[model samples]
Target: MDENSIAGAAREFGGKVQGAAGTVAGNDETRAEGKRDEVGGATETRVGQASDTVRDVAGEAGDLADRAIDTGRDVLPEAGAAPRRGGDTLTQYAKEFPLAFAAMAGALGYLLAVAIRRRR
Candidate 1:
């Protein structure tokens, strides 16, 4: 797919041919060199393949992140309003029943303290 992959494949094929030629001519040194080229070519091809895979995964992650941002933009306003309305309701309740709200808040704080102490 990539230049390295193509070049490595070509190199490997050349090595195979060279190795065969050496065998026919009975040159051990030439055969050894050809075998070395073959291994180097195969390593280069694997490096190219790994590079391609990393590029693809990075592209996919970028696309996924873009989609997530778009979705968040579409949903945020409605999500934001819920908490505002809940806060308004709590304010109304506290105004109408100060003592009850205080008692409830104290009880919640006590429970949180107990939970923290148990963790420690």
Candidate 2:
């Protein structure tokens, strides 16, 4: 958001400069191109805002999933220590259900990425 707003402001400033200079120098093309750039920058700012929203939503969802996983991990261990002994059992289950685990992991990773991107 900050970046987009900064860029947009920069573009706006540049456009004002270009338009002034073009008028003084009598160059229609420079004026037109400057207008185009100003528009592009505005569009980029909007896009950046949209991206930030998506990233925020994704990060929130990921945080929720992480909490759920933490709960599950907590409950499962307390459920029964027999057969499912120690941390190895969970690891083994993950290995056995590779597809399922992979899917979950993928989701988790995606959320993490979104959160990280938003932070940046």
Candidate 3:
């Protein structure tokens, strides 16, 4: 987006110079060039505005996610009521279904391997 804006600005600047030169020289071609530059400048302004809007929206989304996480943590009960170790979570899940967990782990490992290979 920034690249697009920069290109548009450059185009507008060039047009201005051409238009000014054309006006002084009394050339129709020069006047056309100047008008073209003005159009390019307007395009750059629009693109820059759009880029800013996207950034602001993305920032708001991140803030919302953080607030949701904090609210969820506040809702959960304290460990003093019943302390469940890290392994307890895995044990309970595995007891429910051991094969499913193994397959999930295998799939994750395969995905990681593929990603690493692609990077290389």
* Candidate number of the best TM-score: 1
lDDT of 2: 0.82
> Per-residue lDDT for 6-96 in model 2, tens only?
7876887788788778878899998887777778777777777787888899999999999988898788866655655767876987989
Q: Which window of 10 residues has the lowest lDDT sum in candidate 1?
A: 73-82
Best candidate (score: lDDT): 1
Least accurate 10 contiguous residues by lDDT in model 2: 77-86
Candidate 1 clash pair list: none
Report backbone clashes per prediction.
Answer: 0, 0, 0
Each prediction's whole-model lDDT (CA): 0.88, 0.82, 0.82
Which residue runs of candidate 1 sit more than 4 Å off their true CA positions?
Answer: 78-120
Model 3, 1-120: lDDT tens per residue? Answer: 566677777787888888888999999977996888779786886797788788889999999999987887788746433456666887888889989999988999999999999999
Q: Candidate 2's error at 16, in angstroms? A: 4.0
CA RMSD per model (angstroms): 4.9, 15.0, 9.0
Tens digits of lDDT, candidate 1, 1-120 = 678888888788888888888899999988888888888888888888988999999999999999998898797857767889999999999999999999999999999999999999
Per-prediction TM-score to the true structure, in the order listed: 0.62, 0.48, 0.53
